[model samples]
Target: MLWDHRRRPHAFAGIRLQEFDAKAGRLVGPQKTIYHGTDLALVEGPHLYKRGEWYYLLTAEGGTGYDHAVTLARSRDIWGPFETHPQKHILTSKDHPLAALQRAGHGDIVDTPDGKTYLVHLTGRPTTQHRRCVLGRETAIQEAYWGDDDWLYVKNGPVPSLRVEVPGTRDDTQYWAEQRYTFDAALHHDFQWLRTPDTDRIFNVAGGKLVLTGRESIGSWFEQALVARRQAHFSLDAETVIDFSPSDERQFAGLTAYYCRYNFFYLTVSGTETGKRELLLMRSEASHPHGNLEMPFDEPVQLPDQGKVKLALTIRGKELQFYYAMEGQELTQIGKVYDASIISDECGGHANHGSFTGAFIGMAASDCNGAEAKARFDCFVYRPVQHYTDRYEV
Candidate 1:
């Protein structure tokens, strides 16, 4: 059974079950409402398990906010008049705002061959005063035990731990190493494009460059040529060299620190009315609804229309700055510092429950006109700065 949010008013997220016909590859029976979490609204992520004589129904509740939790109910029969857990919520980080791992819930239990039980759940790591999650939701595991009381509980009760005692070697080289990418037969596993599966329409790897054909606006619902990689560290540096020639302001190719359509800072190369190619800065603030757009620079910085331009970003905690360089010139700072914290969950979405994804920094190209201008990126580099504190050489 699963909760359906669409069945509102009459059945707000009603957990319903139906039989599936594997041969037909479809649901083949009449669905029936199995449970309604009246007390704890917005219940979802249901998992059913049986051990000995008891059948357990596990669920996530209280929305996907700071108050999210994992609840348990059980009965002897599959069709249950299930009794709720004594504590109701078996796991959560809701009450512990200061906890390193927060928004803990949506979990499932698994048993090892040696007879140990473990619970795997979703969690978030929030940073800054606004409690925004720049790295999005992460998975956490905790040891669990079936008690003499016939109830399952996370070890040390409910709150999630920062680290778990698990058998595995942490790959430090993969975690901290710098990534230098040049596209070939396939897009690197580290990078991903938004919305579409038809990649050839937007980008391709050829002539030792990742060529991005201009699409609609940066945040267009239809499509956009914006490819990005996740931001895993609190501080890091990103650089890319692009060769693009835009005929007008509408045709643009650049680098951006993006969270969502509502929050981002972009640095693009395009043409101005004075018939000159220049670097422009565009930022979208996390406003009430759509967002508020702003141009930081008083005047556009002109660039030669002939060669490759290197764009760079250095993000240290909440501070973000952009840098640029011409073919033979040294990289120099261009824009003022921005509040990089805005590229976080708190500011990424219009509503509290909407921001589930993390921040990203990447390359993009767009053209409002029908013309599909091409932006060829020579290379893209992601270098992690190893430091406990935000301070480090960039």
Candidate 2:
């Protein structure tokens, strides 16, 4: 069984449960609607597990926000009218507003050999007061208890905890918070071209630099020379060194906080009408159809004559600060801080468009003048203030 959404009445509307059967080596069945959440506006992340003679259906209800939660239903048959849990929500962060983790739900259960049960779920740790989760959703584990009535419950009061006691050795030092891409030969595995653009045609890796050919503007959906990685943290510093001199205003390249082609915050470097090199900070607020607008976040500033320039973005809490530096000059702040939430999936109406992916910060190049401009990014570095890891006990 699976859950799918329809965007007719609204974005992320009518999340209906559907069933499919797998035979032999292939999945062969039509989507048959089994359940439609009557009380919830958005229901998703359905997982069915069989325990003994009863079949348990776990579902993630509500939008993926503070109200996100996990609900349970059970039945004897594989497909039938199941009974909802008496408590409604088996696990959630709604009741505990001040908890370290919020937006808790979408979980899976696993039992260890020693009869210990644990549930691994997604959760979000938001900033103080603002309630915006810059780290996005992350994995959290909680112990589970099976009662005599055959009902399962989260053991830790159904709320996400900052610390959970696990019966095993945990070495947090094994995880690294920094990721550096030298582009020595090819793009790193973490780097991916936005959308389904032809990677071989639009990008080339040689001479210890990743070269991106300008195709469409940053706001165009068809083809844009943009490569990005997920934010994955509330506080992080992303820096990229690029060697590009734009010949005209149409050709530009810079660091970008990209949600989509229409919804993005870009600090682009380009040439003015008088052939003077300048840096421009802009935001693209685009919706479906013709509801699109591009606004300048800061006035264009002239750049010093340098062979290579380093662009950096510092994201902390809800603000994003951009910086630039020449090859040897100290990094200088560019413009005022902009709202980092503008690049979030919630603000960009990702649910309305049925896109569940999170935000991405990356490098982009554009040449709307059809000049076939190229931008070379020598290296890219992403250093998170905190490291995240998942652990399991044998």
What is candidate 1's lDDT per residue for 19-74, written digit by digit as tens?
Answer: 78999999976877666764767778888888788889899887667888888988
TM-score of candidate 1 relative to the true fold: 0.92
Query: Candidate 2, which segments miss by more than 4 Å at Cα?
Result: 1-23, 26-38, 41-43, 174-176, 285-299, 304-306, 350-356, 386-394
Q: Tell me which residue pairs clash in candidate 2.
A: none
Question: lDDT scores for all predictions?
Answer: 0.83, 0.74
Looking at model 1, the pairs that clash are none
lDDT of 2 at 381: 89
**Stretches > 4 Å off in candidate 1:** 1-11, 21-30, 390-394
Candidate 2, residues 278-311: lDDT per residue as tens digits? 8877676544543256555545688864478889
Query: What's the CA RMSD for each of the models?
Result: 2.7, 4.7
